[model samples]
Target: MAPASLLDLVAALPPSDGWGPSVATETTLDGVPYAPYSKADKLGRMADWTEGKDRERGGRQQYGNRNYRDQQVYGANQQNNPFGIIAAEEEATFSVVDNTRTTTRGRGFGRGGGTVFRGRGQRGAQNQRGGARGTFQRVGAGRGGQQQGYDNRGGRGGRGGRRFGYRDDKPQRNRDASIQVRPDWALLEEIEFTRLTKLSLDTPDGEDIDSYGFLYYYDRSYDKQPGAKTSEKRLNVLERAAYNVTTSSDPIIQDLADKDEGTIFATDTILSMLMCSPRSVYSWDLVLTKQGDRIFIDRREGSSLDMVTVNENAADAPLETSEGNKDTINSPSGLMMEATHINHLFPIQVVQESESAKRDMPNEHPFYNPAEETDPAASKAYRYRRFDLSLADSEEALHLIVRTELDAVVKNTISGEDQFLTIKALNEFDNKAQGSGGALDWRTKLASQRGAVVATEMKNNSFKLARWTTQAILAKADMMKLGFVSRVNPRSPNDHTILGVLGYKPREFAAQMNLNLANGWGIVRTIVDMVLKMDDGKFVLIKDPNKNMLRLYSVPNDTFEDEGSVMEKVEEDGDDE
Candidate 1:
């Protein structure tokens, strides 16, 4: 048999299935059944040296060996093969220590649903690269409270996103009230700006009751190419008589009240402030007096309401001396005074001021007295206007009379008609200084980026600009002139230079600002309704110093009497000096 060839022995063997025992009929072979197997199972080496090589390179799907990728345990299916050995029950408690380092990401509540684990792993690869333009990305803090990048351009590229951290370093703004509140002021009602914004009352265009004073023709030379070296002019201080008479102090308003011309009487200065109260940031107070059926809106002498504020609506407005502001000239009060002085002189300087070029109104100057006054009269015209504010549900007519003013007059080139103009000046302090509200360099950008410059002013000085526009519309001025005035030197506050002047239609400018006259009228109507229902007495409406709220108080009749008299005495003393 040993001599038989290997081929002869293979021929003598049975077929492939027949070579195995006929024991297929029996479930088990020698008391052990065959184990079920898969062809895709890895059957490589018993131990591998390159088991954790992938994990060292930051691979995510970690396996014991690359060749045995699908192998979990070495032939551990022991219910079948007789050669298989079962581990003792104590082996189940055996454990191995792994010293691998891992990063655990923290989650937070955001627009995303769950814990977003962004890291140096494969998931964070996209974020490490800068994202698309203008898209915001928020980065989470890493180990040891270290902040990561947060912005649309990512931390590595263009300007980083607005950081919400370090907010405690921001300067606190705690402004004081314009007028001190006394203990005797009894609380009446409190209203919020949100409610005022929702109010709506459609009122008709005002009718001119009477006209007074005179206006000079605009110089037109000031309209020369803005921002040009030739156009720049030194702003000179001019001594002129100007008045801001309150409603109760104006004899004309008193006469109208006597004749039952209107139930509400106010000057455009005070009326516009009330109408645009929602846009104001600084605190102010207006005195409202009810005599019989008439309501008079008046301001106390030397009130801040008469001053034009600078950047009052800015995100980081000018600070006061009390708010840790080191610069005295950039302080809120200081800026306001500078702005008020500029407005007073800027309008007068832009006009010809010649008798031949002057235009007289329908009547003579009501408050001017050449014989008793030494200073020249300012170029001004007063127009008394009336508007109907009565609602359909009201029983009687509700009318309001306001005294509006015009600064100068311009002749239309095509129509050859006299066009009324209202002049306002926007002053620039040090742009590099604190509390500039990110304003542009007016001296350089006024002509090239005029729109952007004006837009910035509109944003920073919303309250001031809104009041001016309201007054212009109230006067029905044909055009509004805005002058750009900058300090002669950034460090100096006394002297200023005119950069340029721009003109716009009153209604068009208001439209550009999205100011609604109907809404303003609605606020007036609401306040009037509240006052008309109350008893005949003096009331005070105060804007909260640090809040968007207006509070009404029932004050004594003589609340500001002593201060008024003292102010008068000071004026008289100054006049004598």
Candidate 2:
């Protein structure tokens, strides 16, 4: 082949024009600013659930659902919301002691009392919580950002202040572990939210109480290296097009909940769910065509369509060919891998890219290399999902967790016939005509109830979605119990795997089993079909049809093939080990 001529390239060039007519942001909304706050989250604040009903009395104030925990709060997620308040069996009372007699009996009675010295200079001194009475020591009258009388021994959590950095709000609850009462919410600075635009309450500049609820939300951004410049090509798992997915209960979440005391444990999964766009286009290449020098490239964009056409015709009309005269040939996806060039001009490049990469469950076990493996402390057996109190629509966030801790709490807290068969029964336990040994413990009730408001709402669709979430988690958990887990990424000697900007290190979240996109019906679909024998498929996942739930097991027909029976009792506790 001879080298292409410069004149040939010049003749193949297509026409170019400036951008089309402009449009302005004023296409819809008024120029005036709306109160940034949307009253959506507060819609259900007064709902019966908020009142710690059947449980101890606690504060209730609902906020916008989609907002960060600083704004997104509901009865279920809020630690301070009456439900989580574990009341002490004995209430404390304070009484002042008479000290005049003691003073009189002292030398003051016999000798004349001396006049007190000037004290205006030291007037700032005061007891922190209560007066130091009798022989007992009291909280000092002064301690910056410290709780007063509440006998809290735990370290100040989070930011250690009120919603507006106010440590001044009266401490609501606290006690040493011996007493077992939870610490004050006002002290858990981590849970507090400052105004989006303001740093301190001392300044009355930016947003107010209402506007604060509408602060920053998760935008599904890419995770670049600490100092690396932001590139459009980099994307986290949730932002990609090949079916991005993640279970809501990240380890980062559990750390926050562990520290939370009456403060809201946020449930931002729904909004994160919305972040995974199904029709999302990850990337595309620019097709540069050349015939002789008459190159033609279609610059027009149709957002919904996948391909762009490029023709090399120099004339306005298509070339008169025997087969047909057409100026169309759509660009194919993944063509970047294809090698077709005119004089080595590499202009057909990937132009658009997703901010995140899609992730799937691993097909095998031991998530990390020999040196890097499960954290040993992270919850691997049963995933914990914190479902939001408010509801929203989501197609990608089809993830679910078994609420292992909640199940344990329910089984231990409520025994025998009192056990709930349905979520409604558990939720309605508060309204029972006969109060069962006081209120049925609101914290227990909220946690016990599978408040999958959105996921469970579509009972039919959730079955399959739940199966994938369950089976994969179960498999990983079982592997973990056996001192191994799925390989999260390809293993190397140092346990390093290229994890984008975060680098080739251990993953922060639970290790997963990938279900690739190539699996005809999708990974989750394939898992469900095989597990449930759906569509008359082979039954690998046993169905415990006691309830409508399609619980999984290896043997479909065995009466004792439930996950608890087969997976745990037989496999985990086999006694061979």
Candidate 3:
């Protein structure tokens, strides 16, 4: 006979509807029959049976009858005619015969030499035995072994074997990591302002006027270099040169002074004058006054003026009067001029053009215009006029000089609360050109003093750090090799990689390892989707993220060789690897 197929047997067996042949007795091609209860079909049948039993026990039922008496009679009769009555009767018949069977001689058998008795009792017994044997054999034999095993082992044995030991199918540990780097510097400055005033005079002997001055404050340390010395030296040299030239009585200076004294002197003197000078002052005085009346006084020099006071009725007097008018009409001799307000002032320093002087030297000439049939004197005069006009225009170019004094108490790192240098300037202007004049015009002299103020505010620190980390990662050779990965879909540009480096020292290794347990290089990228690392005993690129289009990963101790080998191995493994 052909070997039996397990699948074919299962298909041919009864379905899980309590009908057809049992799923047991299926056999492999070698003729080993499978246990029916252990088959998938029997499990399904058991499941259905369990569900049905649960439903019957839990569900509500209705009895259909003509009246209350009929329903009562139907329920009463159900006890005698319970469900499964036919199955129970069949089981009882098989059980009776099975119980009475002789252990060694209960089948169709041939007559032995020891005994051969034929009679009505024997014949009837034999026929009865044959009928019993046929009925019990097939069903009882199939269940015997399985029922015994279930009873002994508690129904757990004979099922598929349980799995044990290690598995290689677990997911591989991740290896990507990430970090951040911030901007190099902060780049802005602040400005401070004050009021200013100026005075001029004319006289018979000369223009001698007593000038009053006021001052303002400014700070310049923001733009000044930290350790600059060239500017200081230049300033000292200029001051000394000005003093020597002005004080000298040399013949050359005298001759030049004689030719066009006013013009030359005006240029030199004005140029030599300090950029900042005080121009105004403030004062106040008080006098006795009657109720509902006005009073006036004036004090003038070189005049025999007597003290006088004017008193007017409050209702008839004008609301206010001028100081000059009040002084001339009332107490002219004992004039009390009260100074109420004063303005701050600053100096304007002129920055001369050194390049112009260098260009004016004879040998430095790059171009020449030869005289062709023109009068030499006329040509020379014309050239001279042109040069003068150019120089005049150039001199008019706006040059602003600012001077300020700084005073402040600062805390020194070594000696706390010590006096530190403060740099201040008069009027600070943006170093750009404007119309005829520069943006700010300051006074010559001011008494105001200012201290340097440094203001700093952080702007987008995380973003700047991310940008720097990205640049650093991209500069790395390993990172550059993955340039193709940086190309992302235009629709989702932000979905990109970022790389960074971190560091750890011997002392920090344990903590770093613990941190790695929750967030290591590879898994970090899985969470934040970026690469990063620790290196040289420090957390280098801790702030980098995917938006930067770069990422970092740690290599073995021999970084250079190991990194190259790792990349080779990854490429060999698969495309994504």
User: Which candidate number has the best TM-score?
Assistant: 1
Kindly list the per-residue Cα lDDT of model 2 for residues 442-474, writing each as its tens digit.
223323432332122113122222222332232
How far residue 357's Cα lies from its native spot in candidate 2, in Å, is 28
Best of the two (1, 3) by TM-score: 1
On residues 79-129, what C-alpha lDDT tens digit does candidate 1 reach at each position? 445555689999667554557664534322433323232222222222322
User: Deviation in angstroms for 538 in model 2?
Assistant: 28
Q: lDDT values of the candidates?
A: 0.82, 0.21, 0.20
Off by over 4 Å in 2: 1-146, 149-471, 474-477, 480-577
Q: How does model 1 score by TM-score? A: 0.74
Candidate 2: global Cα-lDDT? 0.21
Please, what's the RMSD in Å of model 2? 38.9
Per-residue lDDT of 1-577 in model 3, one digit per residue for the tens? 9987667777776567576655655455565443222121111121222223323333211222122222232223332433222456654344211234433222122222122222111111222222211211111223223211111111211224222222334333221221112242111111111211121111111121111111112122222322123212111111200111121222332343344221111111111111111100111111111111111111112111111111111111111123223323122112111000000000111122232221121221111223432321100000000001012224632111111111122233475533222211211111121110221111111111111110000011111122222222211101100000110222221222111111112113223212111111122112111111112211111111112121222222232225467878889899765
Cα displacement (Å) at residue 254, model 2: 37
